[model samples]
Target: MSTADVTSSTNDQKYEIAHLKLVPKRHIGRMIAAAIVLLILAAIVRAFSVGQIEWSYVRDFLFAPAILDGLKSTLIMTVAAMGLGIILGVVIAIMRVSGNPVLSSIAIGYVWIFRGAPALLQLMIWFNLALIFPTMGIPGLFEFRTVDIMTPFVAAMLGLGISQGAYTSEVVRSGLLSVDSGQYEAARAIGMTQFKMLRRIVLPQAMRVMVPPIGNEVIGMVKLTSLASVIQYSEILHNAQIIYFANTRVLELLLVACFWYLVVVTLLSIGQYYIERYFGRGSKSITASM
Candidate 1:
């Protein structure tokens, strides 16, 4: 009678355990937060759709001559400014990491002044350089009136390019530092000059570390070109403003500007992804081995 009773009790316990249901955990707070965000986004979409905005104006101006011209100007400035910035940044980065105190100090000061000041202020100062220097050139060889030469485009270029150099130098410096000292020593042992060593051995490797941030900075520069509007450099925003002021289609013109910016940024982001993937190939292989 006791053996039968123990066997029956064990069988019942096992059956109960097998039949027990697992209840999944609910993330109530996460669901509620997501719902709230969706609602807010829906509201914003509805507001814009039903607002007094002239959607037709936005569509028409999106591809208008003025906008296209502005876009061209923006792209030109981006390419030119970034080219200048890269040259300055590389030189400054080299100086920053060099043995000479004078060059290092000069590089530091350049970064300090440019990075410290707002881009707008720099643009204004450049635009108004005639106040500081009536003319610029070699004293006996050539001279030109500062006001004539310092047009809005030139001023914007100098301002944006120089400011970009300050930030890019830091990125470059970090990339250079990330390289192994052993590589530097090896380059030196091979009878390589400093310039030759950096070009042949260092920069190629450092590009892996430098590409991502530099790509991001390029994207940032696209948006930053809007600041040129203040100096009337006729980038998209400035052109949009001119249109809106005349037609009183401010929001529509702004929307047009925003659309173009998003398009350019999206294209740049795709390019950035490719550049990042290319540079990251070596790191990925190393990581896989580990």
Candidate 2:
């Protein structure tokens, strides 16, 4: 190649790289502000706490068998509820976006009702449902009653998941919608079936948008799992509460639970950072504007 042509090509390549690397000012400012806010909050939390705590009691009691059991229960509920929430959210998102009016209405009403109610209240009601009815059975058929159908664990899952689904539906739907309509049209034009198109094309793309917020919810659910304590499900918080109640060290035990909660949330935030990086690949495209 001629010297002039080679020089032109190198300059064009450099220009292309720099153009595609444009960093928006708003994103930069927001990132700096967020970092500063987090640092300030951490410093403030470290500054407080006039109460004296028995360190040995905290160490022994916090990790005692009952607390461990409660931690296990907390983990079990967290996983189960989030799993159920994601599944239900996907279904509801589909229904809300479905072409059928009846299906959309049902999905919308469900989201509205559940999102409007507090999860704790919902949990309490489900646990008390058996008490209210005494015996639940088929209405038209022989009302042959069965045994206790719902335990506190079952009720807690149903209440927490069902309510969470209302919020997650919107998140999933937003993710699905983030994918360009052209992508769907292209999939159909190429003779892809609906299910395959979604699985192979759309969902992969939507997940790039979905995973972040879902991660946020997962972290939130880690704390929200504390509500199970109210139903006497013996989750981490409940176990801690038991210790403090016995020892009359409410603040200290409460601190332990807070510590664990903070640890779990921080771990999740780190996981989310890597997950975002994983989904973040080749989102750029050549356009006429370019």
Candidate 3:
């Protein structure tokens, strides 16, 4: 109740508050775990760098003419297959979302068949399609023997493109479905045609969701092109196999192929980052405002 008693109590409280620790406790366990992981990673890097990897052979063949040719083929195939796949995917996704039961069922069946089968099996089937149908053509139109047209290139394209379309259709369908239903209703009320509505409103908004996955699919398509080698298509891995088969430097050739694949995928990943950012700008702005 005295003035000195009150002053003494306030000063004691201030001293206690000032002495309290504010910093978070260091997580010694996490620090120790991280150190162990780094040490293990360093050991693995050192072992591989100094191991019997034939780095000289990898360097020598990295830019070899045959490898370069194979790289070119791989790039071309990836672009062509992805282009075809995306177009088919967009069409199929639209069909799946259409009101007609027949169109939706057809799209669903196509996606089911392609996605259910392994891509390699599809390639084999396309390559050996002659067994099922010696000739392929319109019923009343000119026909060609399946074997005559079913080259490695054709088989690879058909297999990769169709298979990719199945997956891409799902991606596109999800993106489309992510758009608010009210947006569709608004577009319809504004006298927009279905195609015009998709082009101007739904798709542009859905692209923010679609671009990332589509980019991943594009990068995956690059690697998937390697499977064409099974059918003897002259992609990067096929060329690497040819070189190593004669030279008995399999690991070196494989490393070279891996280096190129990493380079291509890295480039693609960078492009994807930029594309995602571009499409995501509006969403980011809306989020920030909210």
Give all candidate RMSDs, comma-separated.
Answer: 2.5, 10.4, 2.8
Give the better candidate number (2 or 3) by lDDT: 3
lDDT of 1 by residue, 6-110 (tens): 999999988887667889999999999999999999999999999998889989999999999999998988887888888899999999989999999999999
**Per-residue CA lDDT of candidate 2, range 1-290, in tens?**
99999999999888886546676557888899999999999887666533366666667666778777877788799899999999999999999998999999999999999999999999999888866677777777655322266676888899999998998999999999999999999999999999999998898899989999999999989889899889888799988988778879887788778877887788889989888766766555323225
**TM-score list, all predictions:** 0.92, 0.78, 0.91
The regions of model 2 sitting more than 4 angstroms off are 1-50, 137-147, 284-290
Q: Tell me, by lDDT, which candidate is best.
A: 3
Q: What is the Å distance of residue 164 in model 1 from its true position? A: 0.8
Clashes of 3: 0
Q: Model 2, 278: alpha-carbon shift in Å?
A: 2.2
* Model 3 agreement with the true structure over 210-235: per-residue lDDT tens digits: 99999999999999999999999999
Model 1 is weakest, by summed lDDT over 10 consecutive residues, at 281-290
Residue 116 lDDT in candidate 1: 100
Poorest stretch of ten by lDDT in candidate 2: 281-290
Score each candidate by Cα lDDT.
Answer: 0.92, 0.85, 0.94
